[model samples]
Target: MAYVDGFVIPVKVGDRQAFIDHARQMDAIMIEEGALRIVECWADDVPEGKQTDFHRSVDRQEGETVCFSWIEWPDKATRDAAFARMGQNEVMMKTPMPFDGKRMIFGGFEPIVLLEKANG
Candidate 1:
């Protein structure tokens, strides 16, 4: 089964381009470190909730947009090893994040089921 690392971040509206540039750099590093693929999504229709929501979960402030992202790995072992390497990685250490790191939420998930459409 494939292993995945997922993230949700709140970025200021004015910083969108900066965030994309940052993500590009980070994605390259992750790919070099063994990530199979990286996917990033900018929220289009994220709705506010009365009780709990994506916005509320990240304590999103006014004029901020949510970014949903994920990195895919072949398996848990590779994912673990890559992350371990990232800890001491010089580029990662020096690269500044475009968004608030404290407010970002992230987790690792083992896919229980993934359905795909047949390609012609």
Candidate 2:
């Protein structure tokens, strides 16, 4: 089964382009490291939902939405290897990223059940 790396982050209102620039720079690095696909990315506006809602669990506010992204790999081992490589990259090593890294959350996500993959 393919492995997926998921990321979720809150961006202050009106900073979408800055994040995109960062992603563009990181895309090549991620691909070389083992990402088969740099999947979906989203910059959204808040909708009606509970403060503790699963999607918004880590977010708390009315104005702040999320920047979400996913990277696909062949399997977990490949993903792990990519991460290890990323750890050594100078770009990744630099702390206090140009973009806000704290509000930016990321992880290697294992799909428990992909009920319906098709979406229009």
Q: Give the per-residue lDDT digits (tens) of candidate 1, residues 8-115.
A: 999999999999999999899899988999999999999988998999889999899999999999999999998899999988889898889999999999999999
Q: Candidate 1, after superposition: displacement of residue 52 in Å?
A: 1.3
Candidate with top lDDT is 1
lDDT of each: 0.92, 0.69
Q: Residues 8-110, candidate 2, lDDT per residue (tens digit)?
A: 7766546567666777778878888878888546555546465454246445345555667789888999988888889898986773343456556688778
Instruction: Please report, as a residue range, the 10-residue window in candidate 2 with the lowest summed lDDT.
Output: 52-61
> Candidate 2: deviation at residue 60, Å?
5.1
Taking all chains together, the TM-score of candidate 2 against the true structure is 0.74
Whole-structure CA lDDT of model 2: 0.69
Number of colliding residue pairs in model 2: 0
TM-score, predicted candidate 1 vs. hidden true structure: 0.96
